[model samples]
Target: MQPGFDDPVFDSQGVFRSVMFATAYPGRIQTLESPSTAPTPLSRAAAALCLTLADIDTPLWLDEATASSEVIAYLHFHCGARILREPGVAVRFAVLSDLGAMPPLSFFHPGDDAYPDRSTTLVVEVQSLTEGPKRRWTGPGIRGTLEIGIAGMPESFWSDWDLNRELYPRGVDVVFTCDRSVLGLPRTIKVES
Candidate 1:
């Protein structure tokens, strides 16, 4: 695919379909065909997410480190999403460049029982992604089951996740982006340690 300032011939509908499939089947590896060459701190998975979710209605809050002009321009051109600064505000999408330095997962809206889908969906960019030691995943999306060794996440992430999971249908969903791969951790999936 050609990488340029203009938006590539990305199929937003297809990307959304893939995202749905990924969320419906969490812990399963899914790939998105990105249009760009994949820049540092911006993996193909993150790029695909920006394309799929960010539209005129969705406001995106990017980490200070990753909030560059090039990134903003590209996202604007492709997704036409409005960029914001605060995490607790009305943004629907939040991108974290430094996974280690990210704010507690509790910072964003976790939605409510009446409108669970109204919560923010965070796209976390990490240095690497491997099965973590503390937790085991076995839910609707797993084939048999899988072990995930989370890397570069804050110590409080898992605990926060536990609380988020308790919210059931009213919690935020998450996507971990590394290199060219994406992993979904929807609110519906249960995580056991």
Candidate 2:
């Protein structure tokens, strides 16, 4: 089995902080330094996120391309996160290796009004965060608007994102990861292509 954080306590705390910062300030790119090594098909940033955010209490759903035995074993051995065989509203987190093939954002758990925080958080592996079609982001964290691009997104992504945003407090949050770089797109953010 692959090892997890060298210093589980400190490293997880650090990664958690970085994740919160990115989520708080949407469209901002956050780099994770010296993250734990993940097996093939699992980017280091995604693995680090799984380690930092998932635990015994969180059920993780891994999409087709990322559901390899190595990744399952790694996450299981390190974080004790239960890997679900199918996707459902109960899934607290999901990891998608191919954004183009991912299920609609609405397919995952979008926590209800009573418990909006119960929504699933998606960790998506992509080619580049700065090389795709640019989109403007405006929301809580962003001052006015922030323009950014992400490679490998499906053409229908922005449209789907619009629907997700319409859900307001009850929608899936996204974390885009490429290599060791991470970018958060919380449900509250509005994006225009």
Task: Give me the candidate number with maximum lDDT.
Answer: 2
Candidate 1 clashes between residue pairs 3 or more apart in a chain or in different chains: 25-141, 130-149, 131-148, 131-149, 132-148, 132-149, 132-150
Clashing pairs in 2: none
* Segments of candidate 1 deviating more than 4 angstroms: 1-10, 131-134
Question: Model 2, range 1-68, lDDT digits (tens) per residue?
Answer: 77778888898888899999999999889998535678979889998999888888898999988999
Model 2 regions lying over 4 Å from their true place: 34-36
lDDT of the candidates, in the order given: 0.76, 0.89
Query: For candidate 1, which ten residues in a row score worst on lDDT?
Result: 1-10
Query: Candidate 1's residue-wise lDDT over 87-185, tens digit each?
Result: 764888899887667887788988777888889998988766674465678767687667776677776887888888888878888988877677788
